[model samples]
Target: MIRYINIKNIFIIYLVALIIMVVLKGDLSDVLARMESIIEQRNEGNWNISLKPFESISSVLDSYNRFGVNIVTVKVAILNIIGFLPMGFLLPLLKKNNTSFIKTMLKCLVFILIIEIIQFIACIGVADVDDVILNLSGCIIGYIFYLIVRPVIKS
Candidate 1:
């Protein structure tokens, strides 16, 4: 028989693969633990900072005691950025060709919010408002990149 591949079906496979990777990496537990530790830090009065850029975004960890963005917030935001940006990349493949960028961004934001809620209830991590914002920023950045790169690739 001739080979046939539906792009949507391939995207579903990719999503399943991503979910499996997340589960196998024990990332869920790690995320939970990180959140819990952050909440504990907050309770201990360890949540305050100043506005200064360190070597990397995480370099602020060296001076967390004096910085506004604590380690947990940074970590969670970074995770959201990493996780959701790739997830957004898949949307253009799975979604209708005419889907608007704004709608895609909103869908990514909603997905991040669900993850944030799960993180809060998992008892391993702190549910943070800032994490959602940063994560959405990352998704928007990824979507914009897609917009810029698509025309080039199609040429």
Candidate 2:
């Protein structure tokens, strides 16, 4: 079993386990409730886009004239970043040695899409088209990072 424990294989296992946990721990009704609550809060004009000192530095930390992007865009970008962080860096590890990069990326995309499907079914979050785009971008970025760092890791 120790022989089977490699960085690539481990990432795949971790991703699968995470999906299982998300499914087992979250329910459709709970997700639906959370989404509805978010909508209600937005409609009430209480969804302030305030910026914090450390958190919104790019936005100049201003509450009124903050970053140009809207709340929804930020949220989707965050979600995408979260979902793709691993894919960008660790995803290549999942493929056997000598596997094509495109194939590895495709596999990672499929896996992320599955997670999106689960999120949609559970209603824990909205299944916006933007999320898919964001998540893919994240994965691609992660992959690029991985390629750049691959040589360093081998040495």
Whole-model alpha-carbon lDDT for candidate 2? 0.60
Residue-wise lDDT of candidate 2 within 80-135, one digit each (tens)? 56756676677565443743568766876787667667655544444444445556
Q: Tell me the spans in candidate 2 whose CA falls farther than 4 Å from its real position.
A: 1-32, 35-75, 96-99
lDDT of 1 by residue, 1-155 (tens): 11124656665675576445432336666665666676787689864222233233445455565766586756644765675565566566455465587778778778766755655454344345655666676777767777777777457
Q: Which candidate leads in lDDT?
A: 2
lDDT for each candidate structure: 0.59, 0.60
The alpha-carbon deviation from the true structure for residue 110 of candidate 2, after best TM-score superposition, in angstroms, is: 1.0
Per-candidate TM-scores read 0.56, 0.58
Clashes of each: 8, 2
Q: What is the C-alpha RMSD of each candidate to the true structure, in Å?
A: 6.9, 8.0
Model 2 alpha-carbon miss at residue 111, Å: 1.3
